[model samples]
Structures are given as structure tokens and as C-alpha cells.
Target: MATKHEILSEIDTNFPEYLTFLQTFIRAASPSPPGDTTEAASIVFDFLSSHGISAETIAPQPHMPNIVTDFDGGDRSGPRVVLNGHIDTYPVGNPDEWKHGGPYSGYNDGLQIHGRGGVDMKAGTAASTIAYILLKKRAQKLKGSVALTVASDEETGGKWGTRYLLEQGGKASPWRGDCVINGEPGGLQSIRFGEKGTLRLTFTIRTKGANGAYTQLSRGANIIAAQLIQRLLEIESMTPHLSEELRKHFDSSEVRLVANEIMGPGTAEILLAPTINIGTIRGGFKVNVIPEECVFEADVRLPIGLLAEEVMDHVYSILKDFPEASVSKQEAPSNPANYCSIDHPFAKHIADTTEHITGRRPVQLAGLGGTDCKFYRYLGIPAYVIGPSPRSMGASGEAVDIAEFKALIKIHTLAIWDYLGSNA
Candidate 1:
């Protein structure tokens, strides 16, 4: 095992250039705008090329592109590993919430990188890129390969990114690997095992016409809207038996109480069931005449192994209580949860490497949200999330701990070395 001093030295040697590259990336406003990723993807690919890595940009569509590069581990016939991350981020919301300049300003706050994608992900992407570069430089003759796949449109559904790559045969790409590691915001301490599935449904409710031409007091859609809101709120409040993993993380009574209070009675139970969110509601066409239509769009996050049909059944059950309600339309694009046992050989290696580098053992973590890891897992590849934050502080405050960053580079480097027996 490399000593902490050795790891620190390595990071110190590479840190300057790495920070420069990362800052440049942070400056590029790569928000996912439906099928558009030209500038951001190009910048990432160009950076990789400048670092002496043989990189390729595969633009599936004009707006979204995929940057791929790899190092052939000696013979090029051994196990292949893919390091993946998205190059896009959600739009900078409420710039006033920003402490520095604009969200894409890439302001170096003396201690941490500050920007929109700076924490939520751009940090992970940069860490992964730098680690890969170091790995290629240090472990030159392994028996396998290492691929860096930085894709676009992840802020949205990844339809033009991962999905397009897979559809156009990502597995067929150069340096395509057997398993993948998605560099999501995992706080650099825990290896995220899996994520919950998602279901989006829209409910439209209509009321009977009023018998008035100019003004009708009681014949408007408001009545039906009121009932629908009440019932929908009820459905949103349904709680299921949360997975053991979720309970383990949120164990305090105060947290549980807050969950219940906001989610309503049985919210915990329904957490294990399917989670629901009424995101949008709009009704009432005219003030004088009662409008006859009311609609609501809901977002539901489901735990692993739960079927979308089962979720819809629960929604129907809630609506059935109100006879006048109609469901209208629904769609659930689900990516089943994927987990790797902490005791698995690779996982053990990663954990051991992390501990060796950080003097801290890794805790197993479950994904509260979803990521493109779903796509890789769906394709029969075991994937996990890991990154550079020291705690659960992505999109919030707290900078990426420099120590954690150094430790991750060492851990990932050794893990890859162990996989390829490169040290030999």
C-alpha cells in the first residue's frame, strides 16, 4: 500500500494542472438543454486530448455528444473498466442563492471550487478525469483497459447521452468495458450501491358543465379541483415500509417525525411503498364561468423491485375513494435498483484501498436519487457511485475536502492496479 505521504506527494505534483483544467470546465455553462451539448462536450474532449490521452468525440446528435478515451492494459484482452460521468448540470437556480459571482463564474473561493456544477457533479467529473490520467501514467502495462466516458444530457433523462450511446451500441465503442463506475456525488467516503426507480404520472379531472351562460357560482371546475387536490395530497402522503437501507441512514426520531409530518400519516410505511409528488396543478379557465377541467402532474420515486403497475394501483386506490376522479394518463420509465455486496471481491478491494489511503473505512450507501448507473446496470453491468466530497454536501455548501480528493486518487489508482495486477 502506498503511504499517505506518497499519495499526498503525487496529488501535489498533479494538483496545479488538475485545478486549472477543472476551473476551465467549471467556466463552461454546460446545462442540459434538450439535445444540446456541443460546446461543453468539445471542451472536455479537448482537455483530454491536451493531456496526451487519445480521445474521441462521438456526437450522436447535434446537441448531445459523448467523449470516450481509453488505455489498453498491455495485451488489451483482459477485463475492461469504464469511468463514467455527465458533463451537464441543472440550470443555476436563483443566482441570488450564490455566495460568489454567477453560478458559472468558476470562482475559486480560496478553499473550494464554487459554481453550479462545481459540487453536484463537475467535481466528480474532474476527479475521475485526473485519476484516470494518473492511473494511465503510473500503471502502464496492466492486462486490461481503462475507459473514460464523459457524456452529456444527464441533467435531463440522458436520452441523448447514455441512452443514445447504448442504442447506437455503446458496448461497441472503443475501450468499452465490462463494468462501469459513475462519478456521481457520493461524498468520496461511501460507495453508493444502488438507486430508487422513478415514475411520472399526470392526472386530469373534469367537472360537469354549469347551467349558466354569464355567471355560474357552483358549476365550476373548482369543486372537482378541490376534491382532486385533497385526494392527490392523500396519495402523496401515503408512506410505505422504507427499505432497511433508508431507515439505517435516517435513524433519528426528529428526522422520522419530520418525514411523517410532511408526508402525512403512514408516510414511513408508504416510503417502503411508492413515493409520490404532485408537482404541478392548474385549473380554472374563467372567473365568471366555472371551468370544467382541472389537471395535475405528479412525480413518484419508487424503491427497487417495485413495479410501476403496483404504484399506479396505489394511485387508483386513492382516487377510487373519490368516484368523480379520472386518472387520464401516466408513464413510468423505471430503472431497477442495482447493488454490489460490500463483501464482493472488487468492493472489498475498493474499501480496503479507501481505508488505506484515508485512514477511514468506507460505509456502504444507498442512492436516495437516481443516475445513469441505472442504464449500465440494466445492461447487466454492475455499477457503483463514488466521488470527492467528504460528507453529504453536494449542491449544498462545504467544499470537496482536499484530503479526500488525494485519498480518492490513491484508492482508485490502487483499486485499478489491483484489478489489472499492474504493480507486477
Candidate 2:
């Protein structure tokens, strides 16, 4: 069954050494908020130990580590396949707002391959290290065992790579897996069957006292922090909104025209809305009398089956008439949704292997920000998301598509032999 044009002509004769090992692994700049990545995880552990595979880096602390590699087939106790990524990024924000040249410049104009983890992920770690070297050179008697992790602080929320590899059982060692794949750009024609459940709360409001006294009295805690920031903009325009799979995912119409072009049209028709941010505001430390107080911070976000204690009980029932207003939960709330059900057979084998290699039909949106599939749905492990991003791939002259990097190593070497049934 190896005829996707003979696996894209053997990944087009190993596409110029996989684009020169992804431009020397995206110029080894490793940007994870200075969480550095040990020279890009030592160039993927010296290119998977020069191909024989059995590499390791796994640093829980000594500054940016998490490399871990292993390649073995034929009964390592069958069914195991992990291929995560994230050699850190998300900081090259403004190398002069680069349209072309900046941030560890790994440029290559012969049909794209630019910079900044080129397409948000060093092209899914160079397509999972060329699909595990073409699935150990065409499934050499496949049975199990295959890990190629490279993670590290997944753009800030994996407190140092997959939560330090699940706090160092490293997923119960031997690179445990019964199906795990996270080459996260997710635009290589879709396979992300879930996402959208992040809770960030920060509500700080203070006002009380006197600096110079009586310039016209009436202070009452800076007028109850301006009527509790206008009742948190009416509890951020009504909190108890989203219902049933987050209100049929914002009641489509292209998701209400992309949420009325990013929260406009009267706050996006307030349709099942649940995101509010007054970001930050400081109190009056001066500027004369009645300068009692005025501090505010709001950044609430919730959607997927909304329940961060019912959004802090609808934000204390919309500040239950401000009894000297006060509430603080900067980030304790978390829901981690994306329920995985498109008749889950690992979501129809990643939506029929991304429409059998992209004839287009993969946009089943909802990740709306937040990955590491929410810590593998807090470890039940039915994660989802595919890779090889490409539609004008992350803009600003961004790139990474030397022919979709050989069609993402021939669709992950036939999606790891159709996700491990392997009759090979």
C-alpha cells in the first residue's frame, strides 16, 4: 500500500537533506522566553544520534533541555508512537516587524522557509524529523516503539516542556505512548479535532482612603471602582452564555463572521460571549485629594463547557452590588476543553489523514489558542492536532513549504501505518 507516488518519490530523494536540516534547525536561536533550548536541543540530539536513533537530553532544570529520542521497531511491546515538538518560540515579535529578514534568519526564497520557528514550529520540527526517517525506512517490520519528542515550554504553559515530561516519569519512561502526535502548526490541511478551553482570570479593584482630603468629599472608594468597571461591562456582557458545546461553537456563520471581525459589531453580538479584559489599571497614588484608590485588572476568558466555578459564580453574581468590591483569581481557573468526538477513531484517523493528503477539507476550527492539548486533556490523552502549516503560513513574509516539506514526509509515513494497525 505504498503508492502515494511511492511516498512522494521517497520524500523527493530526501529533499536536499531535509532543507539542510531545516536550515541548521532554524538557525538554532531557540526562543522560549529565554527558556533557551540547549542549542536547539543539541540539533535534535545530533540529528537523532546520526540516524541510528537513541538520543537523550531530558533536562528538568539545567536550562532548556527536553530532547528525548528513540527508534525501535518490531515488538518493543507493540503500539507506541510519540512525536511531539516545540523547540520554543513566540518572542521574535518585532525584529522590525520583519517581512523578510530577522530573528535567527533561516531564510530560503526557493519557495519559502523563512524564520521564527518558521511557521510557528520550525516546520513541526522538520516534519517530525523527516517522519522518523521515513518511518525507520519503510516500516522495517513495524510493531511498536517510536518517539521523537523535542519539546520545551510550549510557548509558555508547559512550565518547561510537557510539564517537565509529566514531572519526570517522562510519560512513564520508555517514551510511553499508545498514540501521541503533536507537530503543532496544524495547517498542513487539518487534523486538530479539538481545542478551546483556556481560563485566565484577573480581577483586581481597590479604592479607599485619603491623600489630601476634601476637594469635594464624595469618594466612597473611588465611587466603588467606577461602579465595578461598569459592572465588568455587564459581566462582560452577560456571562452565563455559552451552552452545549460552547453554544454550537459560537453559532457558526463562519463563527459569526469571525466573531464580527474580532469583537466588534456591538461586542460581537454578545453571542454566547465569554472573554473580557480591562487588562490593567493603577490606583491614584497622587493628583490631589479624594485620590483614595482605583485599581483594576480583568482578563477573563472561558468557552468550552464554561466552568471555572461557573466563571467565578458569574463573577460573584456581577459583583453582588459591590460590598466594597474585591475579587482575585489571576489564573487559577482552567477548563481545557476540546472534547474529541467526530466519531473518534482518533477522530477518523485524523480526518481521513487530512483528506488523504490535502485536497482540502481540514478546517474544523476551535483551538482558538492553547495547546499541549491542554496537558493532554489533563492526561486522559486523546489529544489532536496535525502539522506543516502553509496558507501564506503565518504571514509577515513567513514561510516553510518546500512542497509542504515533502507533503509532511508523505503524510507522516502514511500516518504511521494508518495509526499503528500496521499490516506492513
Candidate 3:
């Protein structure tokens, strides 16, 4: 308790500078699709270097780069904990629609910090970065080590960032740890032990061209695309066979409130069942021309206990009727819904430490969307996400509450301290 108090005191005293760091971080826009994060990566690298923490940058994708740094505990035999975060943010659409001096503003209106990357998680990553720095500063004689991976390409699926480092060095990989901790935006009250998986696909239809009045000469591609969308919605009816115990846990008021509150209303419905979104559709160029081709993009989310292959099989079944229609997944690898038990030591450390800090226990629930955590969970490593509330992630006018962001830094630092310090 004494050590914890000392840590908290140091955090509070140093928080103002941390806020400045966060604002500077937010000001550096690293939106994906364009997927370039060179500037943000350089900023992270320079900051770490300024602190005397050496880092390595890997950029096989050129525009997208990653930053890695590691430090050992007092003893090498203690557990290795990986802290993961991303530099890229969702693309800011329509700069005019944003508030608080626009998306890149990094403006703090006293209560919240406004900007593009703060909610979806440049702020959370900041928490991890600072926690790593604070932990390193302690220079305490503890067991094991903590490694930080501030990577790029997470918003577009991490092909050149975290996944790259994880795949590089075999079993004793540079990024592999006993477990991973990710500061994704899921609100403080909700400690996410699992995440929903995604299958991003583009459905296409093709047919011989014809004049608008000459539909009899060829089938309209737009018609096939519409019918295909209708069939795909059937997949939404699918449900995961979760354990009764897990369902009972979710039934608890603590879990129910946190799940819906963190992810939004009706979260349980979507968290337990597969959900579908038909994002966009494009067909004929002009009214005078019969549509020869149509393309529609979709994002299908699977609940925990469901697999991507299961959904793909269902998709293939639905496409049997239309030979002209075909579907293809996005180039990045798709993952299944994954998790570790709520009782896992790392998860409990976060939940318990948060309760100790705030006097309110956090509830375990699954987040609605995917995160870099899934990549580690796929390899049998447990990954947990507990960060700030996602007030307007991937949308205009994104913000992070000042109080909540502060709480995140404290909780993460102490939980990490609790995990490794105990080993000493």
C-alpha cells in the first residue's frame, strides 16, 4: 500500500506534463486507409529516445512503421508482460463536421480533450507509454520484464506493425509475452477480457452489359448485388454457443451494465449474435446503361465462441444461387473471437487494481469490435483491454474525459506494478 501511494503521488504530480504529451500526440494525425504513420512513429520514437529508452522501428510497409522497446525487471525469471498500442487512427471524414477546433485540434475544454485519435486510442496508447516509462523509472528490483510495442497499421489490421514483430523471431519472439495488455477504448468500468472478431469482405456481381431498355439481353448486375445482400443478412441469425456459466456471468447486473454502457445499448444482443453491416454499394454509371458490375463492402462481426470459417461457410452456401456473384475477404488475415478467462491473473490484476483505486469494481465483458489484442489471443496468449470510454471513436468530435484518462494511467501503472513487483 505504501508503494502504491508513492506511485500514485508521482503520477498525480507528473500528470500535467503527461497531458501535454497526449495533446502533442493527438496533434500528430496518423489516419489509416492512407495508412501512413511515419510522423506519429517518429514522434513516439523521439519521445522515448528523449527519455533514454532505446527503441527499434520496423517499416516493411514503408509508410506504416512500428516502434518496439523492452526493459527487464530485477529478475529475469518473472513473467513477461507485453504492452501494446497503435499509432494509426480511423480516418477523419469531413473536417467541417468536427468540433472543438476541428478533429486534429487536441483542444482541452477543461472537462475533455477533443480530437481525432484520443478516443479510438492515441490516449490509451499514451497511458501505456507513460506507464512503461514510470515503471522503468522505478528501477526496482523486481522479477521478469515488460516490453512495449507502439505499432502502426492496427487500424487497417496490423500487417506491418504488431503482427510483423510477433511473426519475426519464432517461439521466443520479440513481442511474445506471458500475456498482453492493450489500452483500447472500452471505458474504465468495463474491463474487456475478450473481443468480437471481424470478417471484412467485398461482394461483387458481374453480367454482360446492355442498354437500359435492353435488359432482356443481359441480367442487371445491380439486381444480383441487392439479392445477395438480402441473403447475407441471414447470417445475422447465427448465435454462438456460449457456456451457461458465461451467460450467467453476463446476466449479472454488474456485467450487463458495463457491457451495454461501455459498448452502447443493445451490446449484449450484438455480442452474442453475429451482426452484419452493408457499408457501401456501387453499380451502374448512368441511367441509360444497364449495370454490368456491382460491388458492395460488408463488415460481419462474430461473437466469442464463433469462428470466421463458420461464417465463411455460411456465406458460400448463400452464394450458391448466383453464379455471377462472388465474395472475397480483405487481404489482412481474419481472426476468430478470442478471450482468456476473467479469472486469469493478468485480468484480475487490472480489475482488482482498478477497484482498489476507484473503490468500484470493474465488470468483465466483451467489446463489440476487434482490436490488436485478438492477434495475441489467436496465438494462445491472453490479452486484456481496459481504457477510457470511447465517446466518439471513428467519428467527428471525438473526446476523452480528463478524469477518466487520468484514472487510466494510474490503474495501468499500479496493476503492472502489482503484477511484477509481487514476484520480487
lDDT of 3 by residue, 74-126 (tens): 77788899989999999987999988788889999999899998988888899
Q: For model 2, what is the error of residue 418's alpha carbon versus the real structure, in angstroms, after optimal superposition?
A: 7.4
TM-score of 1: 0.82
Model 2 lDDT tens row, 223-304: 6676777766654454453447645655756555543443245433543446666756666655665545566666655545
| Each prediction's RMSD to truth | 4.8, 18.2, 1.9
**TM-scores, one per candidate:** 0.82, 0.35, 0.94
Candidate scoring better on lDDT of 2 and 3: 3
Off by over 4 Å in 3: 214-219, 422-424
Candidate 3 clashing pairs, residues 3+ apart or interchain: 74-142
Candidate 3 lowest-lDDT run of ten: 135-144
Q: Enumerate clash totals for all models, in the order shown.
A: 15, 1, 1
Ranking by lDDT: 3, 1, 2
